[model samples]
Target: MLPDALPSRWYPIFSSAQLRRAPTVVERLGERLVLWRDAAGRAHAALDRCPHRGVSFKTATVNQAGELVCPYHGFTFSPKGPCAHAPVLGRDAKPPAMSLDIRNVTEAHGLIWAFTGAVEADTPPPPWFEGLGDDLRRCADIAEEWPVHHVQLTQSMLDIYHVGVLHRRTAPGSGQVITDFTMTTTEDEVHTEGRLGHEGAKGMPFVARLRLPGLVHLDVGFGLHVLVGVTPIDAKRSWVWARYEARLTPLPQLDGVIAWLGAKYDFTVLQHMEDLPLLKSIEPAVPEPGVDRLIAPDAGAAAYLRLYRRALSGRMEVAQ
Candidate 1:
């Protein structure tokens, strides 16, 4: 979870393919936002509420002049969000003092991002997925809306313990026992080093990295890397997006088909199906240490909470 007092941060609202000249509604960090692009293909983000009647402008449309026209009253607004026209008022008439509350928006790396917070504060650029660089070939992407809180969704990805049990059929760990857990935490990242199975029998060492606010990179070896990001839609809902990338597949031509099918079975059908029923069963949204008896395997979750607290205290300096 993010702290209220922290400065604005860029959060992904839509994939590049999802937004166009039409207004699209997206909820993030507990606020409803409207996203659209202009005739020049410039992107914009604003509060979905129309100032006049407090109705959502999500159903609004863009006019020939490239302004957002409210569906209820035909009040038009510029991309910067000041009122440009009103149906009842004449063309020469001056618009009222009301204006849409627009926020900072940017498009990059095949995603649309919005900066939400105080207007005067300078927001840092969105975090880059280092695993998306030239070294890896991004083969497939998928997103799922989970009923549980974003924190729970994040923890499930970091726990190596669930692999053997929850993913037995889909992931098939070959009866491997996971142990020898170690975790290191910094203000920005949590690094975990562990063994997959019991000592000497093909138990490959595993390394996982989690960046602040829930961006993950799992190095499963064999040129396979898994990237996961969780964006809070509200206190109870979240949008989880993941990308499967590989570098050295024996058959490059079939990589796309293989990645898509693997993600469908292992991620959606196996892992998430197993996690949903269990995570939703937890009583409180944010559970305390004593709520459940946690063992060594839960160190990753513990580290995540510690880092979250440091950030909440406003003591952690975010690198721009």
Candidate 2:
């Protein structure tokens, strides 16, 4: 059931820079997937198992022709997963269909996205950050492996109350007790707005966009945004990718250097170092609602769960 809920949507399996000369192995939705790039730099994903003798693609190699070669049987497969050549059949014979089970894959925003289910020409494109454009430049891309359910890490982002407490020293002056907190939700998004201290102070508005199968966007103010994507490695592990980007300023000389430094410092000290240790300490993985008492400050996390459940229901409806 957990695995089925993750299909039919795109998941960022690798960053564009990570796929180089060799084939890479990725575990998503409880399956071992092999990702490789063709001669033209197009990415593809398929079950790691070879059709003959079930040898894992981890032991295989990408041949000069851009086809994945099975070391055990010398069968060559195309990017679309069909076996194109076999040594036993000589050069002229065509291999049978369904020789390799390939899935859908595409690249965008410097990330390699892989679809875990069937995809047609009309399948929707992966979700994009609304305000980002070509003018903006990527400053940092941080990828890490977490020891909890993907849901746990996602909900943490939505937990507005934790800011003042969990990140007091790392992210001081932010996440103070929010006043007049109100939360709004949509089929796949959530919004929360409030003040850090008393009334009349500057408002801190948080808008979180969620896509089925684990993709989220968190705006970090100052024309900077963070993109968080969680790929379920298995039932107990998840791979996380976070990207920090900022708009280009008028001064090209200092913009690039400043953006890089700010992104690296905040991400390393403020976010990754501060949050990872606390998140790793949470027990029982995914916690059920009402298991712990909730106060008014938890409005953001609560709203996130509602939208998340709605997405799951929508997926089930489509299946029916």
Candidate 3:
């Protein structure tokens, strides 16, 4: 989420590598940014504006000194965003750090998260963090994008409505499926949690919950964790980035299989392919203020959407 202040920033932006193999310019909430990796290999996000004269630095070419330089006046700035030295001015004068607005940044789970708010150096990455990176050599879980508003896509993960219709063969259904669940919410968050008592041999329908206006963390089977990271691209579009990893399952000897099976069971790709059309066709409907149009089974759906709208109101910058 984001801090509702002029100086505050949010992690509602792109994950690492998603941008590219190199630096890129990303826009969110109407603000442009220069996202680049420093010489130390640390990822950094800056205001994208050169301190002197306000030229867009993301478009500025990188100079031999490893600093971003504006072609118009030859003013160079470091990765930290301070003017390294103004060739037109003098190398003797140093730019004040105060003049540069540096964002709190961290790269994890393949995302380069930055907060415009007063973020601490230790603010954890999105809750989806699970040893994910570009190497692709790590344990099976891979990150990919689903073309849909992140919040909507994520909510689908916990939406029991589809668990039976879309994935009738999986948990919460296993046996023709029943229609009973609960969706509750709070001021800052909403959760849809329920269980599918002895449906088949699948041992109870494991248990699931969706916390919105963002973040969907679900448990498919015996501690197998499926995390979906959502980032809004705009009002009607966004990214459904998810990580299918295994954790907390009581099957250690089958850990590898559990992870692989977990990923497979999630059928992440197959599920999204089917969901693409529906999500793409649906309108961008932001829940109205003080409305409770929920039915008996509409528990979690309503709660999740409400919390999500609150998240958006806080200025969660959409991850590009």
Candidate 4:
């Protein structure tokens, strides 16, 4: 099971494209949430259950005023969760003291992020790879639900040593031995840089960075960058959002094409064909310290685990 008090951070839950005019239902952080957009296209999130009758907001509709109208009893709620209307009473009648549990939400980098902290004012803007710019306009976005705990999925990304063996079929020549692996950690981030080595093969350098909770950025050289965010849906499942950016050429048009092709090949072929099978076989779903042996090459994953435990214990204070 995941820690009850997860690090208070913004967690990506769904692709922005997936949430449209209707109220979309999503499960994250072990809670059911309803997401919708206002007329201005800004997103909002609230608990999925209506406070009045406990009806699920999944069957609700968004009125012209952007209020969520419950399908069961026509109880209406505004974007901020206050009861806006109650059809059982007169149209203009005052609503009772009823409201949904509102959650802080925002759209960024082609994904919908929910702040998992208590005080919204204390939360910082969603974290992104400054190297990827303010948006993912030039990248190809893809999302999938992996049937493993989010911690497992995240650690896999930090474990670069698996590339050569796990991805050998899809990414040929990636199975080189690791060398000069170095990892640095701060209060809420982990940064790693290393080189790949193999006899008779030229050395290739790589870089990976992780922002607390579940965000990873990997630079594989040749103008290719990979960003991954793992959000926990429940103890046994997680949502993985990935963006692939390829800037092999000077022209923006060509770069866009390459990004799209690379996203398909890397995410669909390499990930689905290789990583998925092995990841699903991991035991205990969620990893605990001392459960597995660590070697020199597992430095990155080790750092993440250490930070995760600190966050869970409420000792890792995030700067306000």
Which sections of candidate 1 miss by over 4 Å?
A: 1-7, 119-122, 133-137, 174-176, 198-200, 250-253, 315-320
Q: lDDT of each structure?
A: 0.73, 0.71, 0.55, 0.82
Q: Model 2 TM-score?
A: 0.85
Ranked by TM-score, the better of candidates 2 and 4 is 4
User: Residue 195's C-alpha lDDT in candidate 4?
Assistant: 81
Candidate 4: regions farther than 4 A off = 1-5, 120-122, 133-135, 315-320
Worst 10 residues of 4 by lDDT: 1-10
Instruction: Give the TM-score (vs. native) of candidate 4.
Output: 0.93
Candidate 1 or 3, higher TM-score? 1
Worst lDDT window (10 residues) for model 3?
A: 1-10
Task: Show model 3 residue runs off by greater than 4 Å.
Answer: 1-12, 16-22, 27-32, 48-74, 88-101, 108-110, 120-147, 168-186, 196-203, 210-213, 247-269, 289-294, 310-320
Candidate 2 residue pairs that clash = none
Clashing pairs in 4: 164-175
TM-scores of the models, in the given order? Answer: 0.87, 0.85, 0.67, 0.93
Candidate 2, 58-114: lDDT as tens digits: 878888778999888889998877888889999988667547878778998778887
Ordered from best to worst lDDT, the candidate numbers read 4, 1, 2, 3
Q: Can you give the lDDT of residue 171 in candidate 4?
A: 79
**Deviation of model 2 at 256, angstroms:** 4.2
